[model samples]
Target: MSKVRIYTLAKELNLENARMLEILDGLGVSYKSVSSTIEEDTVELIKQIVAEEGTGSADGEAQAAAPAESQATQSQATQSQDAPEQQETPQAAQASATAVQTRDDVAPASKAEIPHRAPVVTIMGHVDHGKTSLLDYIRKTKVAAKEAGGITQHVGAFEAQTSKGKIVFIDTPGHEAFTTIRARGANVADIAIIVIAADDSLMPQTREAIAHAQAAKVPMIIAINKMDLPQANADKVKTDLTQLNLVPEEYGGDLIVVPVSARTGEGVEDLLEYISLNAELEDLRADPNGQFSGVVIEGKVDKQSGVLATVMVQEGTLHVGDFLVVGENYGKIKAMMDSAGGRIKEAGPSTPVQILGFSEVPTSGEKVSSAKNEHAARDLIASRASDRRDAEGAQVLRKLTLEDMMGPLTTVRTVNLILRADTQGSVEAIQGILARKESEDVKINVMLSGIGAPTEGDVLLASTAEATILCFSVTAPGSVTKIADNKGVDIKSFRIIYELIDEVDRLMKGNVEPVFEEKYLGRAEVRMVIKHPRFGNIAGSYVTDGSLKRNAKAKVTRGKETVYEGTLVGLKRLKDDVREVQTGYECGINLDWDGAEIGDIIEASEMVEVEVA
Candidate 1:
């Protein structure tokens, strides 16, 4: 006969090993440790005994209902116990019977196998893609109208009750700066809704959102908004999505594409129906009685209140007065408010609530877990701090570079380098020469090219990105070099631009095998347009990433389509001519393409050869 270990039995019965051992002792069973095995007969006997003991109190009311009938039932139960055939019920059947009992009736159980909960959905897409608008229509609120520039700046969590069921929606920002925030939202969500503009199809940010959702491994639902517009083209949106491997259900794939008008509340009901059906098929569930844990969706310091944190409880129920250890901080929950701003004493799994008791503003995406008491919370915090200190002391930071590779390898296709020069003009000239050195198989990426001596910040960035620092007509301070040496970052100084270009060319072809590809410089968003008489349409833009270069090959992207592609003619800061504009700075850009409008993105790139290992 097969035998089961005592510890395994304890786990199946949801009882502590120590408690199980005590019970075994009381029942006169031979068990040395939790690891000891019990025969199949003994296991069944133990299960039956435990089941009887568990339901003894719960059956008291029934026993009192009719004494004669109860006595008769007891006699029958005793008779059934003696019958070998009656005792032949499968172990699984007995376990199922035990699960039907409540936690109050059965002691030491961890969680319950019960009803499934609603799914948590995250809405993500490109800028001005109507993500917030769809959510606003669903929740019957003007959340989109309240934001400046009609764009969401941060992540917002809210619960919506639809005809299908309730869904917790996390509306993430569409801007490029909040890429991390969007990924965090997807990580905590069960399903992701990729909102696409029906007229515009898919933009760069929309593709980024799709990538984030795919990385998180969550099911995606495409929501094509703005269907009420005359220019709305759902078919085009679907065709574009197929290029990203998101085939629609109507096309015989599993993906569901819903075309809806956020302004008129069209096809939203069908979207919710599909979401609810998907959740049902997925069988998404959580044990509310399990250990309380959650993820912080967003955290911020409020001037009126203290640290306000929006957390989505993943498991168990959170009650008022419960002490929580959020990231490195710990505090007792003073108050809890639901998505609708209503005060709540308790919150269960899949519920998003704004809590007001964190010691400090916890970082977004930090795990939130409950501690047994205030002392436990403090102890956890102290232990975490000590662990971090020990790890930092023992950790050796090293950034892997092409020079680090040994022997012959064919994996390195691109070289990541940081460029620093004495002047902007020198930096531009060196970049221009490097751009020409690119081949079909090799490409060089200037991750950071700025005008100044290489500083500690540049060294740190190089170390983190595993990029070599190239200085033209500029030097790195001794302290910065020391730090770079310690971090295994390379700092190469060159007096001439040709020397830097030759080094890159050697690394690309001579030192390593190679090919040339398009090197993306940066992206800028057109905030305003100046209709200059002689200069034509001048795009007043803010650099969002990297740096916008003057006289670089640029493209004006209107939504998913590129409207214009040509060289940028005029790059200026106010009236003064500038060779480049860095991130966070506003400048005037004049390209041969005059179709650049407010909200359109301008991308700058150069052709360069990259090494192929």
Candidate 2:
């Protein structure tokens, strides 16, 4: 057999481990395993094995030993020190040396470190269900007590530092507030603390809260509150909760049910502990180094300040003086205050803070961002507003298409119609008909449709939705009409639906001309009243500045204001009926009223025309 050595065997292989085994088995190398502390006898044995293999001559060994002579004398003696030809085999020696080095490089296994984050808890229930009170109890503050009424008026975010960590609580004023705040609670919070009044069991708000939380896909903790009340029933509350798909932790489910009394501070600590434990299992974490982003919980115009907005920082840090663009508004953060009213220089991820210095009040649930500067913030806000306007315009245009009116339409074209009716049934019927009307170009969108006289809110909603106000057998209040006129919102009243529908159709067909009537400022003298044979009495009056047409709608003016608005039932030129009555012309005008006196001036005017909307 050919003489074999470990280094020679190593040089003839591809894989490192295979090379090591080839050298060991082929050379018949029988030696003790190399320990951490090398023994001199073991080294000698390895040298003897290499020598016995005798793959090279003495002069080749001399050349191999010569290269290591200056570094180590013992290694030089073991290496080939004979012919200069042996120096070419050092690459094989290096490979064998690498294999030996790896044997000593073994390390123990390690575990990965887990990240941590603040717990996000949401307080939810029906209105007046003690959700706010329970949150106040857990937070050890008087947030609910300080509100306008005993109930919370808005969505409030607070942070409570417990023994485990910090727990962020979002207090929404029942399910309506939750839906109003971005239409869902899942978007706002991670865990939901459903507060149910023990005495009431399962109320409408309670079911709404559960539906919202489940829709959000968040874990729920049932807080059976009002245990201090004499009529409280804990078991009934639990059963009701179970009916809403909330199985308690004790009943083979993960949900925790804690009985508490927001009025008496009972079981508050236990509730907090349960939340903390749930958060631990969830392993919630946020990247604090990311860009500052959060949702606007609520906003309002301050009497002292310009626009005050409450924001919940979901990630990164928001500092005071940072330029922020919230929805359509932009401003530098003049001040940052926490829930406790303490001034904060900076707010990290999950911290809810009230900020001052916005130009306008951003809508609740609008995402807020920290820009680089005021100019940048303004540009970003303007860009976002432009984008939103474009999107809304496109949506409106799409809704006016045949495809939008077809079967199984996903997007509904809603034109907010502020309906004011004389009676409740009238309002309901008008709304129902308008809602069912099939239109390829335009559909009715009623935001605030009520039965009473048109109020300021109706005008505001009309202005906001760019919609028209439809009054059925009712009139708009003076203040509301003035506001609508100022805002350029069309307000139309109809005694007949067919006429209104026909007018709307004509308007939609682009054939209807808008009729604008001059306001009847106050009438001059009623002049004289004459009794007629066939018709009723006529008020012969002189023309004011504007021409009064026959059958035109007019208001009966007495002093300086209008008393009644009706059609000019009769316009006769000295017993002869005329179609047109001009200014500076004497005409016999028969008003549509029985109580028209001599002093009561017959003011002629037409109804302000609005495009069918």
Q: Which candidate tops TM-score?
A: 1
lDDT measured at residue 286 in model 1 versus the true structure, 0 to 100 = 85
Angstrom error of the Cα, residue 350, model 1: value is: 0.6
Model 1 steric clash total: 17
Global local distance difference test of model 1: 0.77
TM-score of 2: 0.47
Task: Encode model 2's per-residue lDDT on 251-282: one tens digit a residue.
Answer: 54546788999988888877776777667546
- Best prediction by lDDT: 1
**What RMSD, rounded to one decimal, does every model reach?**
23.2, 21.3
The residue-by-residue lDDT of candidate 1 on 350-378, one tens digit each, is 99888889878877677888998989999
**What C-alpha lDDT does candidate 2 achieve relative to the native structure?**
0.66
